[model samples]
Target: MSTDSVLRFITAGSVDDGKSTLIGRLLFDSQSLLADQVAALYHGKHKRTADGVPDFAQLTDGLAAEREQGITIDVAYRYFATPARKFIIADTPGHEQYTRNMVTGASTADAAIILIDATRLDYSEHTPALLPQTRRHSAILKLLGTAHIIVAVNKLDLLDYSEEKFNAIKRAYSKLASALDLHHISYVPISALNGDNIVTASAHMLWYQGQPLLRLLENLPVANRNSQLLSAPALFPVQRVARLDGSSADDFRGYQGRLEQGSLCVGDSIRIEPAGQNSTITAIYTPAGQVEQAQAGSVLTIVLADDIDISRGDSIVAADSTLQPTRNISASVCWFDSKPLNATRRYWLKHTTQTVYTRIRQVDYLLDVQSLNHRQDSDSLQLNDIGRIQLSVQKPIVATTYQANPATGAFILIDEATNHTVAAGMITSLV
Candidate 1:
C-alpha cells in the first residue's frame, strides 16, 4: 500500500456507462490535467454541456471516429499521479464488438473498475437483472486473472442518489460475482458526470460510509511480482545471443532475455529447456554493468559456466525446476479475428520468445459469456468467442499453467497466411 507504488487499472462496462467520464472526472478533480488541456476542453467543438462545464468524456475520446460517434472504440491509455500513488488507467471500449480491445487493456492490469449505469437497472425488483456486457466484462476480467475489481454504480445522480437503488444493483452484481467466483471485489456508488463520489465524498449520498473511489484505489494493494517470484525457480526465455569475435581470447558469449520468473544469481545451476543441457551461471550483466544477481522482470544478459548451444526461442530455467516441454496443449482462447477458427489451418503460436507452427487438434467447447456455461454444439470459434481448444505444436515448448505463471502460460495464435493475430490463449494444461 505504498503511496509511491504504481497501480495499473482499467475502466470497463456496458456502452454509455460513463467509463470515459469517470476517468475525466478523476483527472479533472484531482487537478492532474494541465492548463492547455483544460483550455482545449472548454473550446473544443465537441463540447456539449449546457452549463458551461467542459464535457469530461472528451478528455479520453481522442479518436475522430470516437468523438463523432460519442463512443469509445479503442483502448485509450492515460497516465497520471496523485500524492498517494501513480496510476496508469486504460479506458476500454464497452461495446461487445470491441471485446478484444478490452481484453488487451485488461491483460496487464492489476485492478478493474466496472461501471454499472444506475438508470439501466430496476430498483423496485428484488434482484435486478444486470447488463449482458457487465457480465461479459466481469467474466473476462476473471479469466484474465485481474486480482482487484471495483463495481462503481454510476449515474446515480439521475436517480436522485437513491441508496435503495444502489443496494439493489449491488445485490444483483454480488450474485454475479459469486457465480463467477470473483472474490476480491468492492462496491462504490458514483456519479461520474456530476463528479459525485469520484475524488471526494458526495454530500448528496450520506448513507454510505465507504471511502470514495480515488481513496479506495490509492489504498489498494499492488502485487509485487518480483518479490513474489523470488523463491520460485527462474524461467528465462532467450531473446538474443551476443558473441564476440572468435579470435578474441576473452570470448564474450551471453544469452540476453528478460527474467520471466524467479531469481538468478552467480553460481546458480540452470538448464536449457528442450535441450536439457545443464550449466551454471558464471555472470549476469545489465545495461549498467555486471551484476551478481538478477530478479524477475529484469532484462539482462547471463553467461553460463558451460558453453551450450543456446539460441533465441530457447528457455533457461533453474536446474531443479520441474517444468517440462510439451508439443500438445489444452488451452482457453479468446478469438480476436473476424475469420472463424479453422482446425485444419496451421497457425503460428507465439509463446514468450518462441514461435512454433501449430494446428488445432480439437475444439473442447465454447464458453457462453452470459451464462458462464460450456456450449458443446459449436464447431468453430467466431470473433470475440471464448473456447477451450486442444492444439499441437511442430516442436516442444516449455510452459506452465496460466494460473501458475501467466508470463509463460499466455500465448497468441497468428494466422500465417495474413500474419494477423487471430487469438489470445491461456494454457490450461499440457495435452
Candidate 2:
C-alpha cells in the first residue's frame, strides 16, 4: 500500500491547553499504543498523579523536565494506525519559548490541529484571551497563511460540556480566520483527556451531530494542495546523478530527482536551469521501469537525449518555457530568529535542491496577527514575527510564488554563524 494514504498531522496550541493528553487519548482510543506503553503510563516513574490513576498526559511527556513541570517542552512525535488510514503525529509544545519548534513541526503537516481551550473565551465580549505580551500571536500569525486548520476546542467537559462555550471560542477564532482569509476550517469540541468526542461520539455531548475527531481525520478528503500548479509549468530539480553498474550501461547517464510540478512524459522537452540548455526526455526510469508519463512526486532517474553535462543542484525544467533564476529578490518571510532579523545579517538560502549565500535587503514591515494589518516601516522582526522584505543573494536560484506553487516556493534560511534554521520564506511576487 502507498504511504500517501497516511496523513501527517500535528497538534499545536497554547500552553496548559492539553496537547499531550489529546495525543495520549488518540493513541489509546485508536488502540495504537502498545500494551506495555499504556501499562507504563499507569505505573511509570514519571507518572504525575496525586491519586493512583495514571496522568494520561504522561504518555507524551516522557522528558524529566516535562514530567516535573507537567508540560511539554519540545516537539513529541508518535505514529499510529487504523484500518482506514495511518498517521504521523507531532504534538508540538505550546510554551512561548518553543514557538520555533511548533513552526518546524507544522511546516510539513498535511493538517493542523489548533487546540483551543474551550473555557478560555469570554462569551460576553465575544473574544479570546489574546496573549499580546508573548509569542503566541506571532506564532498564530505565521501559521495563518499556510495551514489547513482544525480548530479543536478541547476541554469542553470542563465547561460542563456546554456547546455554547464551544461555539463562543469557535466564533472568536472564526473571526480571526476570516480576517486572515482562511475558510477551509472545521471546529470540533472535544475533551482530549477523557476521549470524549475524540475517537467516539461523546455520550454527554448530545448537542453535537457531527463525526468525532478520528472519523473526521479518516474521512477528510486527501488532495494535493498544489494540484492546480501542475497545470502550468513543470519543474524537475535534479537531486543526484546515478550510474547503473560498474561496467554495464556505462553509456547510460541519468538525472535523478522527484518531479516538483506538472508532469513529465517520455519525448517531452526539458531543460537544465542556470545553464538553460535544451533537451528531450529520452527515457524516464523508475524502479518500475520506464513509464510513458510521470507527475508530481515521481522519483525517477531520467535519461536525456543530450549527453550534455549535468549534476545535482541543476534543475530539469520544461523547455521553451522556463522559470527565472533570481538572487536579488523580494519575499514575504516569517521571522523565526530570537535575535531580530537585520538587513546586514547574512544566512544560507536553501531553495529547491540548491543552497546559496544570501542576506536581507530591507526589513519592510511586519503583520498584526489579530487584525491582519501591516506594521510598515517596522524597526525589526523578533522570533515568530511575520514580515515582508527584499533579500539580496550571492547567486541565482529557481522559485515560484507561494500561490503558484508551494513546494518550490517555500525555503528556509540557515544561520551561517550557528547553523540554526532561523527563517521561512514564500515568494510573493518575485522581483
Q: Identify the candidate with maximal lDDT.
A: 1
Per-prediction backbone clash count: 0, 0
> Candidate 1, clashing residue pairs?
none
User: Which whole-number lDDT from 0 to 100 does residue 139 have in model 1?
Assistant: 82
lDDT of 2: 0.77
For this target, which candidate reaches the highest TM-score against the unseen true structure? Answer: 1
In candidate 2, the residue pairs with backbone N, CA or C atoms under 3 Å apart (3 or more residues apart, or in different chains) clash, namely none
Lowest-sum lDDT 10-residue window in model 1: 43-52
Question: Model 2, 1-431: lDDT tens per residue?
Answer: 23347788888778877788888989988888788988877787777655566567888786889988888877788889899888888888888677777777776777778787766656677565543312243344344354457778888888899987787776777776666666567888899877898999999898989889988788665566546556767788888897766477567788998888888889998878878888899899888987889887778889998877887778888886658777776777777778888667788988888888998878778987655678886867888778888887787777788666767877889999989888888777676
TM-score of each: 0.95, 0.88
Candidate 2: list runs displaced more than 4 Å.
1-4, 62-65, 119-124, 131-147, 225-230, 243-252, 290-292
- The CA lDDT at 11 in model 2 is 83
Q: Provide the RMSD of all predictions against the true structure, rounded to 1 decimal.
A: 1.7, 3.4
Off by over 4 Å in 1: 1-4, 122-124, 247-249
In candidate 2, residue 334 scores what lDDT? 71
